[model samples]
Target: MTRSTRGGAPVAPKRVTPRAQWTRGSPGGTAGTPHPTASRRRWRRTVIARRAADHVCETFGADGIQGVCGHPEIEVALAEFARYTGDRKYLEQARLFIERRGHRTLADIEFGRQYFQDETPLRETDVMSGHAVRALYLAAGGVDVAVETGDDELLSALRTQMANTIGRRTYLTGGMGAHHEGESFGLDYELPPDRAYSETCAGVGSVMVNFRLLLATGESRYADAIERTLYNVVAGSPGEEGTSFFYTNTLHQRVPGSTPSPDEQSPRAASSLRAPWFDVSCCPTNVARTFASLGAYVATSSADGLQLHQFVSGEVKAELAAGHVSVAIETRYPDEGTVRVTVAETVADEWELAIRVPGWARSGGLLVVGDSEPETVAPGMARVRRRFAVGDVVELRLDPAPRFTYPDPRVDAVQGSVAVEAGPLVLCVESVDLPDGAGVNELRVDPAVAPRVADGRTVVTGRMARFEPTDWPYDPEAEDVDETAAFEFALTPYHRRANRGPATMRVWMPCA
Candidate 1:
């Protein structure tokens, strides 16, 4: 039987086939033993799942595919696949999954409906709760379906949830899922540093949702969130060479040991160093795909004109509503905030060139066009619409000054501490950056000292004071000798931790 896709898109009928096979790893001995590792098992399960999905696609045709609607990630993927392939079957399946959330289709045995996001329908849910990755994935799917089907209510609901999440649950480093207990989001303003369950997968999902929202609404705010997450959380999750990964990204590590524990999956358990692979291994895979597909997030074409969301050294060609536009973006962005967009080809006579001015650049950076007066851009996006010719140059000078950031007063952790941020990167002090005896907790940052760029990283000069624990728990009479010392410490990007071997690290530093 043949099935037609939604939106009147043409598709050839696919037939079901059996192609499952057993495979072995690299040979070791004469006959290698079966690898019983969790990584191997996980890979095997993924292969099986893909085959099963193919079988489902062929057996049910397009529109005939239907289930009880569990596993929000799979549902989201189905929606995205439908959109990409112009298949209505998967889109309908995605909608069914999203719409039936509150009906309790899945068995919520121990954790209940909240864990599976079944207690409340997305449209009615006020705040995004439960599993952080799952919630973000579900919302992203909603955005995909809503944009395709012209459903404004669903889009609005998701926007509300996003706004609430950004205002309350999100960390300064753009990490998500505040509570370590369920690996889920906690109440409003419940961000905790040591107890954070900000999984790397969640950071990837945050960018996914923000990108979709930006596509659906053409909002600059979503792009801002995308930039922050990409730099601080997503970039920081992986090691420098991309071999090791941190499953749970923490804001602060108070202890000295730098070893990966067997129970590293627990958010409370701090793995000071990144591991080659984790028992779960979701973050590594997610990071791989995210980095590979980063070009799609850099720019997009709207009815008004072309838009550049991210700054990267690449060429973007798009057929916009105005006409065909081609431009080359050259910059060492995130390292420095100067992007030069040279118009390689512009077919249209006039079209708006919208560029995002990051939220952190509050000083209203300078935007200069060819032979035009330098203009200041507000926090959102700066646009210039005029007759354009070939070789037109647009220069955007963004403020890359390092600034101190403080968390909300309601957040109990890091109350008196401050985090340093330069461009999109969140700076952290590693033990390797400090003196031999000066611990991370003992080093204090003098806010008055200006951070300087050195050795491709930011360095903060500050005063350090070593506090010795006395035998008496409470002693009003304590001799205060000279324990203060001056030190210049280098701050590494949060994402690049564990790259220089395992060491203690702290994002928030106490003021001296």
Candidate 2:
């Protein structure tokens, strides 16, 4: 698994490597010219972020007292913007609002409570207050900033609140957030199959807040929750097209033609397509902020070494006490688990590189590659402690095979259905890839048959399935029968679903 940098012979570190050389101008000074358009786009993104922050601050009261405005959603937006942009002004505004307008000493905002709509205060004993804590964590720049600023009071307060929330709310299935309306959390241990909220945005937000806390405290629990959320909840939120977004991500889907009204007060059924952006509009912008600030969440450094949290194709430059060390991480992740890390311009010193071998990957018997024979990093995490090297390269590989996953038995909608996944992407059967209206509720797949990639799509041919008409004979027991029909169907990555056309799509399909 190990590949030598140069012909198996240990090569001496050069003052300038290929990457450094490429970064610098060539002899003619014509190379390494910066792209004006690229630079402008980056600047424009910053501008837009700043403007958004300003708008949020201006629209909401700056003093933090209950304003004429109803809820703290605007403040949440402002605080999140501050987290990414590193704007002190926005942070201060967020702080003032939370400290002043927020509920008394120990209480925070409750989901769907009067405070959320009418600005009425509520008790925050141990509610699954992920949303409010998320806003507070973002406004305060996470746990790291709190520690650095020596605000032990605020840090302890937040940690206590979050710990209580996490300890009380998490389901046996590891799901959090329990209310479908306003996507809020319910009272202690109140998760039910048909009532579980577990909104995709809430999962993303909870993970984000936990990530910041992990970075600050170097705790592993936060990272564990993050992986769970990423693999199960967040990955299921997007449609195949990567455009339409799910407001709620259920483990199951409601039968076709049984769609519920917006105010029906029921958990949404899982589907392959995203609903239109909600009036709350938290998930879309939440996705944008997560992607935009992803770099900050990848790795961390101290006097000792670096910790690689997430694996992707990117380079991280850290400033160590000895000098500057740039680590380039090249990997085909979530697709193929091979990851390579090349160290450059690093002084000879003992350092540690920690890699997260996802829980699923470990169970599948993946291997990590170093200079010697491959090593098995346990699922969840693996760490390598080694001495100095300027050009040392490390590679790790995980299992990357397509598999089908069934919903937790408690989730009613997907009881007999299953989802297809490869690497990190969840796949779905799209109606556009099927034959006209025949693709509607009639989609069914044989569990024993494997789907193959053809014409840039994953397709399956199996026994036919039937969808009851919009208005048909109502018989719950009859709908579960496996009719001896057959049809060929194709699926796409969930993130790329809606891009093709208006078509019914289903992530969970009946398994024969």
Q: Pick by TM-score: which candidate is best?
A: 1
- Report the lDDT tens digits of candidate 2 across residue range 1-512: 12111122211111111111112223331223334544655555555666665655666546433443333444445555554444556666655455443343333344433323222222222233534323333333434345434566766665665676666665323456666654556665555533556666666667766775665566545665665566556655655555556666543333333322344333243433455445555667776666676666677765645666677788887765566777889987766678888886576776655555655553633344445767655654455566647778777777756677666565554577777776556677755565654553555678877766666556676566554454557766556765655655776665554555455666677776
Where in model 1 is the C-alpha error above 4 Å?
1-70, 259-270, 454-456, 470-483
Error of 2 at 74 (Å): 8.0
TM per prediction? 0.83, 0.63
Clashes of each: 1, 16
Q: In candidate 2, how many Å is residue 7 off?
A: 32
Candidate No. with top lDDT: 1
Q: 1-512, model 1: which lDDT tens digit per residue?
A: 11111112211111111122323322221112223543566555544544554455554444554344445786677775554334456666667677877666667766567776888888887787888888888888888777767889988898898999999899888899987766788889888777788988899999999988887767778888998999888988777765667888887776666655545453333466776656577787898899988887888776546778889998887776566778889998877889999998886567767777888887767888877787777766677777778899988899786788877889877787788899888889888878764568667778787788777678887776645568895765444524566667788878777677667788888777
Ten residues in sequence with the least summed lDDT for candidate 2: 12-21
Candidates in order: C-alpha RMSD to true structure: 10.5, 10.3
Computed on alpha carbons, the lDDT of every model, listed in order, comes to: 0.74, 0.55
